[model samples]
Target chain A: MRVSYYPGCSLEGTAKSYDISVRHVCRSLDIQLEEVPTWACCGSSPALKMNRLLSTALSAHNLALAERQNLSDVVAPCPFCFRRLKSAQEEMARDPALRQKVEQTIESQVNGNLTIHNLLGFLTERVGMKAIGEKIRKPLTGLKLIPYYGCYVVKPPSVTCFDDPANPTSLDEILRAAGGEVLDWDFKSECCGAGLSLSKPEKVCELTGRLVRDAAWRGADAIVVVCQLCQANLDLRQREIGLTDKKEYQLPVIYFTELLGLAFGCASEQLGLDRHFVDPLAVLKRKGLA
Target chain B: MFRLTGALSEQEFLHHVVQRSGQNLLECLQCGKCTGGCPIASEKVSGPRRLIAEILSGMRNEALKNPTWWYCVSCGTCMTRCPVDINMYQVATALCELAQEGGIAPSERDIHLFEELFLKSVEKYGRVKELRTVAAYNVITKNPLKDMDKAVTLMRKGAFSPLEILSGWAKDRKVSRIFALARRTSEGGHE
Candidate 1:
């Protein structure tokens, strides 16, 4: 199955590992990711707060690009980008006049009209977990993963249109496909204080400390997330927090796609396992899932 | 039994409350789950769920004026735990925005100070420069010594790095775009 892909900004940069793993996993699943050419930033998180119209227009431009490509479903790995693009699509689809307005606004910014899909939705709805399960050569039998949803992926259901706002089951379904056990946790949808991590590292540290500590305490071998910001926060910031607090927690945070790649028997380099601040290969090797 | 007489009609008031909170005020089961799950609500008299009802029932003036809204940390606990999935943090943010729009000055000095410091950091550096931003905040708030010991201790432990605090081009691009967008939006009054 082939679908248009929007790698967003993070995927090309800091979270390039996620993009690599996603491409590898897609190949393993026999899925083609035709990347949306010349897509701009999803305006990030602050765009929504700054100018609703401009932010919506920024996302709409990407969607419009996808539409031009005749790719109805565009897979986005970053939850923030997913939320922004999907929310813009939903808003535009609901209001024709709004769509026209945004199109006019972003006519020169990006190419084509688009429809957006977060990785979870694309995998579950389009690819089907059944197909994914069939491709799992190395089943993660005893590997316990804490699925961290973060805030953007499931909130304000009007835009996301993926899963239950309070209780999402799509990630859990995907994890189960790889023969992995998911823990029931409250912080699943909790904020990792993403952008605030820079502005307010103390608060970020405090919040991240709680999340990491909770995942570790719950006996999770690793935490899986879709957002680059969430991954960076839980994976990298946790180390800083542990150091500052004099607490010892070297919890490995892995992208959901990386885990899927491992389950599909993809190489460690293909999953970019070494690039992570926290090495997850040791844990995967120990579980014999690598 | 108190009555509220306001410019907004009852339905209009209810709609406004629901729009801000993104939850059906009338559909609330009054289970207190919002209050129960809220980290800040536990420490305050007016929890989010109760605040929603109060705002919906034409207690607009009081709800708009309430200080409890600012206490919300935007942690998403209340929204996640709510059986009906009410976004209480959004409600709190809306109320705060409304207050700001109405020219209701912030009671606490930290609000403006933090905002100024944060915006300045974003504008000048294109990303948040932690040490500089914190230093500016401390200077403006007159609490320069606060967190100093913790900072020193962390530095000694090699947990804090000057390089990390200095915003680089690699880190600045994404953050710069966000800031530029924010500035444009704020200037447009569409925020």
Candidate 2:
């Protein structure tokens, strides 16, 4: 149950809780997350906008590194990183000339080829939701959660190839297994203005506010997400947007792994529940699951 | 609008015009796949599929200048459903680049405000600081009415601790190095 891991920049920074919860839950489930010896940012959405070739090359370099390590499947938790890395792999694998160019870029930058897997896909497809369910010591009873796919996990299915673009079920299935009720919401696969969060923060905030308010309106206790950017936008920016737009809304945003940690009986502090901009502990406590 | 009495054929126009992500243009089959799958398709302006159709039909000026092009969120649903695998998201982005180059009016105030907040985060800390970013945004947008109750409730519950913001730190040297690499690869661009 061991897999190579690429934590990407967000996980190492603002999304540390995601990285911690992922590791803790995986370890509890007997899955070993072997961190890649050396990894770099996958260029994320910034590169895609600036230069396609350069972005692809940057992501491909990480993939090449994984290939050199003989780890064909590299698990990436951040959706932007996962999408970019996996997109590069799909593009390089399909075109030899492009692959050669990308490999040359990789050689100049780092020194290898790599293949990537979204952590969600790896967990759901390889580990099985049922196995995860078996590990849940405290069922998240009475807690209604919205599974937000955002953009990275399901988009460009040709490259990501993880779930249905229009209707993804991987996260939903996992949440259900964690003993939480999953909400059927339209904003699950919506764009949270992720890459544009920096280039267009207000737009990101406006759109993200809508998504969060929608979830809260739908009776979701909290929204569960896999991408760090999506989590950041939904959790932190929503507050700002609500203020700016003269709307009152509070929907705690939690990483799916954190919820998994909770369901597995890990204490709230251990999962960094208190650190979220939106407090979810009382909600879980009210449900008698915390 | 005045019509061109002796304009080049559609093929000639497509050949002469600088096509962005040309592969995407050629792959789009007008099957309406993108329109059908877009989450924001029903919004005021038509979605990316129509934008692509305009481009393909040699409505070069109209396609590149449309405000709707910038509205694309880049969700990739259009790209995912395109039978010919057209990267409509990229194409729409290319159109945006063209619009920017043409020196069109700056985007709406909301868009500028968003940019300012984001840049403030990067300039001050070299990366996004969630709390500061939100706080700055709230100040600029001048809307503090919303989330006051929730903030108070969470604060009382110890879930919204001030420690979250006070603990914010600059990205380490390694992160800086990655940003440098990202800059070099993308010609010194920051998202």
For each candidate, the DockQ is 0.12, 0.23
List candidate 1 segments past 4 Å from native. A95-101, A107-115, A184-186, A239-246, B1-3, B7-32, B38-191
Per-model clash counts, in order, read 9, 8
Per-residue accuracy of model 2 over A1-290 as CA lDDT, tens digit each = 67788887567556778888999998998988888665666655444543456567667766665665565567888877788777777776676666765655555433334546788988899888778878989888888889998887888777687788778999999998888889898877877877555445666776787787778689889999988888867876765867876777778889999999988999988887877777777788888877
Q: What are the candidates' interface root-mean-square deviations?
A: 6.7, 5.0
TM-score, first chain, each model: 0.93, 0.93
lDDT of 1 by residue, A1-290 (tens): 77889887567545767889999989888888998766666655444432456567767766766776676568888777887776676667776666665655655333334556788888888889789888989878999999988777886565577688667888988998888998988787777866654445565677788789889889999998988888877876765777877878878888888888888888877787766767687898898766
Worst 10 residues of 1 chain B by lDDT: B182-191
Span of ten consecutive residues with least summed lDDT in model 2 chain A: A106-115
- Give me the overall lDDT of model 1: 0.69
Reference-based TM-score of each model? 0.71, 0.76
Candidate 2 recovers a fraction of native contacts equal to 0.23
Clashing pairs in 1: A63-A113, A63-A114, A64-A112, A64-A113, A64-A114, A65-A111, A65-A112, A65-A113, A67-A113
